[model samples]
Target: MRFTFKCYATKHPEQTVIFTLLLSIFLLAYQLRIYEVPYFRMIGLKDFEQFESAVWLVVITMGTVGFGDIVPVTIFGRMITMVASLWGAFIFTLVLISFGSRFNLSTKQKQAMHQLVSQHKAARLIISAYRLYKLKRSKEGMGSNKSVLSESDKGISSLMRRLKEMAKDFKDERPKRRRVKNSKSQLI
Candidate 1:
């Protein structure tokens, strides 16, 4: 377990997250001077007593919220806040990229998934077309029930619409399949 964590920590995502935490803590230590501001002193935040208020300030600053109820007073403290803001944004972006990369399928996996989807779409199109044809033939033979015929017309329209959409999906998939096959053949 420790070994796994060590390897994972070496990756960009984990490093950025850990760096963000460390940086935030460092900034918070630097901003400790801000509690001496008259406003904070009046609120009894001085002397690090019940320091959740300080934590809130650091977190809000890092998040770029800066709610103004609490703020860094000294020049160094303000500078720390600025650094936290930029670092927070940068870390968050890296974390997002990490998540995106984690979920990304390999090219071969994507190709296989697309092929399966294309086959399914083609099968659905064929089934819908067959159903529409059967409905038309039945309607012509059993022309007695007008309500049933009207319902069949609606069913036929719906099936035709579905077939058209599936056909389009199948057609759109052909180019992508060709590209995947070409790439695979080239690799071999």
Candidate 2:
């Protein structure tokens, strides 16, 4: 899918920005911890040497990988992990819902689909109706069997009769309308 700023802004302006901001905040907090928290640990950080290493840990945690390379060592760090996990879940759900809404068909598109399906159904109904008509005519031609149609044949005849009535009802004959003119009000 191609990315457009307009689409992003129109779809969900606040959600996208807020989610990113929160994730950045988490990354920053973990990186800038003044002292060692027992539960949170960055494996390769000898003395908070690199910010990127902390970012890497945050990303993996947010992604729910939890590779065991870096872990939360203290109670405070554990609380951070819990918050991150909850945030990740919320963000994931939001992303899924957004994806569904974005890819869904527009009203006009859905209506067009409905029309196409209706047309196809009508075509099939017409074909069946025509087949029934042909069967009736062929039976009429068989004079010897005219008086003794099978149960199935009788059912088909009944169906054809109903279809004929339906066709008559659907016929495009409009009732005449009487137009009333306001003769009292003349445009002078």
Each prediction's total of clashing residue pairs, residues at least 3 apart in sequence or on different chains, is 0, 8
Model 2 local distance difference test score: 0.58
RMSD of each: 5.4, 10.7
Q: What C-alpha lDDT do the candidate models reach, one value each?
A: 0.74, 0.58
Clashes counted in candidate 1 amount to 0
- Using TM-score, give the best candidate's number: 1
Question: In model 2, where do residues sit more than 4 Å from their true spots?
Answer: 1-22, 25-57, 63-70, 141-188
What TM-score against the true fold does each predicted structure earn? 0.68, 0.53
